[model samples]
Target: MRNLTTSTFSLSAFLQRTQGKKVVLIYPWSNLKTQFLSSYLDQAKDGILYYRVPGETVNLVDWIDGMLNEFRTVLGDKFGKKTSAALAERIPAHIGEALASDLGAVVKSETILYLDDLDQINFDDEFNHWAQAFVSALPEKLQLVISARMLSRHPWDHMVASGDAVVIGVETRKSAMAFTVDTDDRPQLECYAFGRGNILLNGKPVTTWEGTLPRTLAFFLIDHPLVTRDEIFHAFWPDLSVKDATNVFHVTKRKVNERVTSRIDDDKQYELTQYTSGFYVASEKLVRHYDVQEFQEAVQQALVASDDRREQLLYQRAIDLYRAPFLQTVNQPWANDRRDELRRLYAVALTGMGRIFLRKGEMNRALGFLSRAAREAPEREDVHRDVIRLYLEFGMIHEARQQYDVMEQALSSSMNLQPTKDSRALLESIKARS
Candidate 1:
C-alpha cells in the first residue's frame, strides 16, 4: 500500500522539516526529541548553541546573564576590545531583542538557541512569561529550539497557529520513509496512537490506511473495547440518517479490515473487528495491541500495585508509554474527546511518578514529576498542592507562593473556579510554619 523506503530521523531530515519555523516546540511526550537533536547537533556543528538545563532550579535572568557572558567569550573577536569583556549589574528589560540584534549583526548565519531538558527549570508563571516573550522578541536570524519537555504553561499555540512555530513529529498519515522489522512472531496489530498514529501489523509497519476514514475508524475501534453500532454511527456519520449512516459505516468498516488484511501476505482468515450482541469489538481471532490501552492499564495496575517498587515501576511504564497525546492528527469530536481522556490519564501517571519518588525521599525527582503533572492537569488541585508543599520543603518560600498563584490563575482561567478551601489552608499553614 506504500513505498518501501527507509527514512531515518536524521539531522538533514529534521532541518528540512523544520526549515522555515523560527520556534521549534518538540512535543513534550516524545522520547526522540533529545536523540534527534543530539545527532543533529553532532552533524551540524555550527550556528547552534546547545544549553542543557541543569537538573535543578533555573533562574531565567541568571541563565540569560550566564549565556551572554559565554557568548562574549565565544564571539568576542567580533566585538571591539572595549566591548569584549564587561559584566553588567542587571539584565536589560529587552534582553532578547537586544541580544538578537547584537548577535545578528556579527554572526554570518542564523543562530539557534536549543534549550534541552526544560523540565528541569522550575515552572513559575513569571519565568514562563519571560520565556514566551523572549521567543517572540527574537530576530529573524535568531531561533528558539526548545525540547519537547518544554512546559505547556507557556502558551505557544498562537505562535504555532501563525506559522512562526512548528511542532515536530505530529504527522503520520504518509509512509514514514522506512522499513519495519518483523521482530515479534505473534500476529497482532500494534496501534501506537501517541505522537502520531503508527500502526504495525505483525511487527511490520502499515503505512497507508486506504483512506482517512478507515484509519480513524480502526483507531476508534481499537481504543474502545466494545462500542455500540449506533455510537459508531454517531461518531463517524452523525449528520446522516440511520439507514444512510449504517450503509456508510459498513463500507468504512469493510475498508478498515481490507487495509489490514491486505498488509498481511498470509491467507489466514481473520476479521479485524467483530460484531456481537449489538456491540462491535476487536476480533478475538486478530490480536490487537494499542499503546493507549497498555498505558491506561499500567496506570490502573499502579493504583492497585501490591508494593511501592512495583507501583513505581508500573507508573513509570505508563508515563513512558504515553509518548504523545492520542491521535494527534485526528481532530474529530470523538478523537478530541478520547485525546482529552488519555491526557488526563497521562497526568495521573505523572502524579503517580511524583508520589512514588516522594516516598523514596527523592525530593528533586518528586518535584519535577509533580510540577509537570500540575501543568499537564491544571485542575488537579491535589497535584498543585504537592508542588506547593515540595517548594516549601526546598525552602523556596517565593516559589511556593508563585506556584499557588499559578494554580489560582489556571483554575480561574480554565473553569472560572477557585482552588479548594483546603488548598488555600495548606498553603497558608505551610507558609505560617516556614
Candidate 2:
C-alpha cells in the first residue's frame, strides 16, 4: 500500500519494488493521474494484466468475471479458456474455490495483475473478505498492483499480517528526502545558483522561471536582497522609461508570485517584500539557502582567518561552492562585477594553496595548483610568475619559457602592458638555466 504523492511516484522506484510480491498503488482519480499510471505501466518491462474497474454496479460474481475477461484477453491460452469458462459458470458459493484453483494455473513468471482505481468498485464487507482470500490464494509468482484513492474497509490488515503487503506513506517518501526538495509546507525556498541559476522549491525546479526575464529577475532578487524599483528597471529593462518599466515590473512580479504560490503550500507565501525605501527583496519570512550566499560567506571567512591552515581550509570551502562564474548564463552588466570578484577570489585561493604547498617543498602539487590559478586568471602576472619559477626549479626550462610567453601575450593583448621587471628577470634566469 503506497500512499502516493506528486514526488514519490516515479517509474524507477515503482519498478524496483515489484520484485516478487503483490503491490498496491493507491491514488485519487484524475485524467492526468490516469494517464501517468497507464503510461508507466505500459512501459514496464514485465507483462501486466491492466484492468480499470467498470462504473456500473455489479455483483461480486460479475466483478470477478469482468476481471477474468481482462486477464483472458492478455494471457489468452495461458489463462486456460476451459478453466475460465468453468469458473464463470460456478455459483456464488463455489466461486472462491474455482478462482483459487484457476489463479494458480494463470500466474507465471513476470506476470502482474494491475488493478487501477480499486476504490471505484464499491466493496461491501463480504466482497472485501473474498478479495482478501482470493488474493492470498494466488501464486507467489503473480504480483498484484492496485491503485485507488482509498481502500476504506478493505481487508488489508489481514493481508499485511500474513507478510503479503507493505504500506508506504508520506513519511516513507520523506525518508527518501535526499533525492527531493520539500517545497510544500516548508518555510524557505532553497535556491541553487552555482553552475546555472536554478530556483528550486520542494526539490523541484519552479516553472515560473522558465522564461528568461522571470528567471533573470529571480537571480537578481536573490543576488540583490534589497533592490529598488529603479535598480530593477535599470538592470533588466534599461531601454524603457521609468513608467514603462514600472508596468513590466508589476506584470512580471505577479507572474513570479503566482508561480511561487502554486509551488509552495506554506501559509506565509514566498514573496518579494517592499521596504519603506521602495526597495524589494525576497520576503524576510522566506529564508533562502543560496549557494552564492554560502560562497561569499566562505570567502569572507577566509579573509578573516587568523591562521594559514584555517585560511586554506576556508578558501577551499569557498572554491568548492563556486562551481562556476555566478549566474554564468545571465549576461547582464550587473553580473560582471560579481563575476570578476569571484574569479579573483578563486584565483587568489588557488595561488594561496599553491604557495602553501611550495613552502612545504611539495613541488608537483604546488605546480598543479599554480597551473589552475593561472588558468583562472591568465593575465595575473603573479600567478604566471610563480608557475614559471616552479617550472625552472623543477628543471622544466621549456615549460617555464612557455609560461612566460603566455603571460607576456596576455598582458600585451588585454592591457597593452609588458611583463614587469621581475617577470623579465625570471625569464632571463630560466633562459640561463636552459
Candidate 3:
C-alpha cells in the first residue's frame, strides 16, 4: 500500500509549482475535493476562483455575458475592464472560444486558471474544437487545472498527451474501527475490530455472515442518522400497508437480535440500537468517504451564500455537483421527496443561470439553459415562460410557437386553466413576427 501522507505531501509540492505557471492538472472524476486545490493554492499565495459555463440546455452567449458582468463586479474596475472586453469579444461565438481568448490572457500573465468540473461540458466536435483552441491559446505562465469525474475519450487524451498535465486518482479505504463477529465458540460473540477486514466473534471469524446487507444497512443508517424506522420499512417494502409494515419491523428486529444477541457478551450491548422511531448504527468512530458528498456539500454551500453572491456560486455548484440525480438507483419512497427537491433545485439553479446568460446577450446559451429548465420542470410556468421568451428573442419563431403550445397544454392539464395573458400576448407577438 502507498503511504497516503507521503503521496499527499508530494502532490501538494507538485501543485505549488504550478502556481503562477501555465500547467493543466487533469484530476479524475473520483477526486471531488475543492478544499484540496484551495488549500494548495492558499499555501502558494494564489487565489481560488470559479466559472459558470452555460449547460447544454442553456444559451451560451447569455451565460458568458453574465459571467463577465460577475467578474467585473467581483474584481473591481481595472481587472473587470480587461476581463469584460475579452469576454464580450469571445462570448458571442461559444464558451470554448470565449474561455480560450479570455482565460488565455490570464494564463499568459502567469495567473492560475482552475477549470473545476470540466467534465460537465459535453464532448462534441464543436466542444472539442473549442477545447483545443483554448488549450492551444494557453501561455507558458498560465496554470490550467481541469477537474472532472472521468476522462473524456476524445480530445482529452490528446490534450493530456501533448499538454503538461498530471493525473491524480483518489481511492477510499476501510474505516479504522469496524465491527467483528466471531462464530468459533459454541455461542458466537461480537467484538470491535480496529482496522481489520473481518469481524471476530468470541475470538473467531464469523463465517455465517457472508453478504454485505448488514454493512450496507449500517452505512445507510450512519449516513442518515435522522432516518426513521418507517422510512426504512418503506424503503425495504414499498408496497406494504402500514399494518403489514409492522411485520417488517418484527422481522428486522429478529435479524438484528440473531446477529447482535448471539455475538454480544452478557455485559455488552448490541451495536445497532433503536431510539424513539429510528434505528441507530453505533459506529460513530467509523468515517466513510464519498465523492458525491463532497460535491453536494460544495454546491449546497455555494447556494446558501448571500443573494448578491448566489448566482456565480450556484452556477459553479450546479456545474460541479450535478453529475446525475442524487442516488439515481435508490428507488425508495423516502428518497422520493429528496429527489424531487433536488430536481426542483437543479431546475431553479439552471434557470437562474439562464437568466444570467440572457442578461449578458448570450441568447444561444441562455436558450439552451432555459430550455433545459423548462424540460426538467415542465409543470413550472416560469421555466416555460423563460424558454418562450428566449426563443422569441432569438427569432426562433417555430420553436417559440412550440414552447407556447407546450405551455398551453401543461397549464390546461395541471391547472385546468388557459395560458396566462402575458404568455398569450407573447405568443401573439411571435405569430405577428412570423
In the order shown, the candidates' Cα RMSDs to the true structure are 15.7, 19.2, 14.1
Q: What are the TM-scores, per candidate, against the unseen true structure?
A: 0.56, 0.56, 0.49
lDDT of 3 by residue, 302-362 (tens): 4443442444454556554565665554555644555676677677767777877877788
| Total backbone collisions, model 3 | 30
lDDT of 1 by residue, 93-190 (tens): 34544555566666676768777657765666655555565666667777788763334634677778888887653212122332122223435566
Clashes (N, CA, C under 3 Å) per candidate: 3, 4, 30
lDDT accuracy of residue 156 in candidate 1 = 70
Better of 1 and 3 by lDDT: 1
lDDT of 2 at 94: 50
Instruction: Judging by lDDT against the true structure, name the best candidate.
Output: 1
lDDT of 3: 0.53
Which has the better TM-score: candidate 1, or candidate 3? 1
If both were scored by lDDT, which would come out higher, candidate 1 or candidate 2?
1
Candidates, ranked, lDDT: 1, 2, 3
